[model samples]
Structures are given as C-alpha cells and as structure tokens.
Target: MIYCCNDHVELALDVIVDEYETFPVLRKLKEEEKMSTACEYCRKEAEYMVEN
Candidate 1:
C-alpha cells in the first residue's frame, strides 16, 4: 500500500495502477487511526491509503 497526502493522491493512484495493472482502492485515514507515516511522494503527513 502507498500512504500519501491529498496533493499526491493522483500520483499514488497512477503508481498503483501501473504496478498492479488494476484499479486501486483509496481510503481516507480516520482521525482516531492517524499515523506518523509520511506521504510516499512527499514529506507531508499521509492522509490516505492507496492499495489494490
């Protein structure tokens, strides 16, 4: 899965599709489940999880 911020969500989606050759699932992080993980493409805190 790729963790990304709003600004990079599109890039994350493209990566998932190019690598997996299938549609990706995008999920927003719940407030109670927020983590310290940074965006896969940038230094901002991740707000969503992108996966197959």
Candidate 2:
C-alpha cells in the first residue's frame, strides 16, 4: 500500500536476495499480481517481523 523509503526497500531486497540467493519470484509480479503469492510471503517474513 506504500512505496516506502528506498533504503528500507533495498535492505528488504538485500535480505530476500541473500536468502533466496537470486532474484525473487516477486520481482516478476505486478503489485496486485504479487499479492496472492510472493508479496504475502515477503510481508509475512520481512515486513511483518524483520525489516530485512
């Protein structure tokens, strides 16, 4: 629902990229398209508890 700060977003991307070890499946999806799958998982993982 928000385009957060770039640093924050990048940090998030970093952690996901680090663990996933590649471009995430979310990157390919539109925000809405992503909602059902990748976005939710990311939200649950990084956005919810850990910022990265």
Candidate 3:
C-alpha cells in the first residue's frame, strides 16, 4: 500500500523483490528511487507489528 498526503508520500507496506515490479503498493509509491527504500522501510515496520 501507499500513503500520499500532498507534502509527501510513503510506502505503507513491503514487497518482495519480484513483487516490486508488479506490486499494487508500488504502483503509487511516488518516486522511482524512493520506491525501493520505502518498501524496505515499510517491510521492517510490518514485521515488527506482526511479530508483536
């Protein structure tokens, strides 16, 4: 998923390497560079939430 609020946008979820290319979340991740970074960051956050 992706969250956009005018000033900035962020990745709301993580995606696999292969899923990156066709992930629904990445479709609106904002920038091309930020896309990957967002995915990684969101992935960690997601894991933390799930683990707990």
Candidate 4:
C-alpha cells in the first residue's frame, strides 16, 4: 500500500504493468529496510515495505 506524508490512507496509482513483480523497483533503503515509491498523503517519497 502507498501512503502520503500528509495522510495515513493508502494512495492509489494508475500503473499498468505486465507483472506486479516488475513494477515499483524495490531497493535497499537501509541495512534492514527498503522503500519503493512515494506516499499519497503529503508527497513524502519513501515507503516502508513488508515482504512476506
């Protein structure tokens, strides 16, 4: 889910991808954490992703 910096709700995007795994290029933001895209709350680009 994507969230902005001003709101706590998940932000929606119109991204069309052939596969979900190919979208939102995941990258290491820290030693134990990573971020994908920006938030829809306040335009604060940085998300804490939880992979299961």
Candidate 5:
C-alpha cells in the first residue's frame, strides 16, 4: 500500500504487487527514487521501508 502523503492520504491499500505498476503515482515513485512510507492511522514513521 502507498500513502499519498504522510498526512494519511492513501493512494493504494491492500494491493498486490502486480497492481502496483498500474498506478502512475507509484511508477513515479520509482522514477523519483522515493520510498517514503508511514502509518495511515497513527501517522508515525513505519517500522521499515518498503522498496519498490
């Protein structure tokens, strides 16, 4: 799942890996080399990063 921002806006949630490529923003995420992830509920930094 990918959050639109740290403010708890979700771009995708509970998605399969195959579905990732369908999201243009997720693709942009890879090109930009950004792997920022956070909790949608608590708004805290995630325990670990999720690489694209």
Candidate 6:
C-alpha cells in the first residue's frame, strides 16, 4: 500500500496501476490513523491509502 497526501494521490494511483496492472483501492484515513503516517511521495501527512 502507498500512503499519500491529497496532492500526490494521483501519482500514487498511477504507481499502483503501473506496478500491479489493476485498478487500485483508495481509502481515506481516519483522524487517529493519520498520526503516524506520511505520504510516500512527500513529507506531508498522508490523507489516504492506495492499494491494489
């Protein structure tokens, strides 16, 4: 799974599709869940989880 901020969500989606060759699942993070996660493409707090 890739953790991403709003700005990099599209990039994360592209990565999942390119690497897995399937549609990705995108989930918004809960407020508590956002505490320790960071975006894969940047240092911002992650707002979503992207996976296939």
Taken over the whole model, the C-alpha lDDT of each candidate is 0.91, 0.40, 0.31, 0.37, 0.40, 0.96
For residue 6, model 5's alpha carbon misses the true position, in angstroms, by: 16
Off by over 4 Å in 5: 1-18, 21-37
Candidate 1 per-residue C-alpha lDDT over 1-52 given as tens digits, one digit per residue, 9 for 90 to 100: 9999999999999999999999999999987545677887887889999999
Where does candidate 4 stray beyond 4 Å?
A: 4-36, 50-52
By the TM-score metric, which is better: model 4 or model 6? 6
The lDDT, on a scale of 0 to 1, for candidate 4 is 0.37
**Model 2 TM-score on a 0 to 1 scale:** 0.34
Cα misplacement distance, residue 37 of candidate 5 (Å): 7.2
Candidate 6 residue 39 C-alpha distance from true site, Å: 0.5
Candidate 5, poorest ten consecutive residues by summed lDDT: 24-33
Candidate 5 on 1-52: residue-level lDDT in tens?
Answer: 4443334333233242357655333322342334455544565544322224
Off by over 4 Å in 6: none
**TM-score-best of 2 and 3:** 2
**Superposed Cα deviation of residue 31, candidate 4 (Å):** 9.5
TM-score of each: 0.88, 0.34, 0.19, 0.25, 0.23, 0.97
Pick out the ten consecutive residues of candidate 2 with the lowest summed lDDT.
43-52
RMSD of each: 1.1, 8.4, 11.9, 7.4, 8.5, 0.5
lDDT of 6 by residue, 1-52 (tens): 9999999999999999999999999999999989999998887999999999
Deviation of model 5 at 22, angstroms: 11
Those runs of model 3 whose alpha carbons end farther than 4 Å from true positions after fitting are 10-19, 23-52
Best candidate according to lDDT:
6
How much is the lDDT of residue 47 in candidate 3? 20
Q: Candidate order by TM-score, highest to lowest? A: 6, 1, 2, 4, 5, 3
List pairs with backbone clashes in candidate 6: none
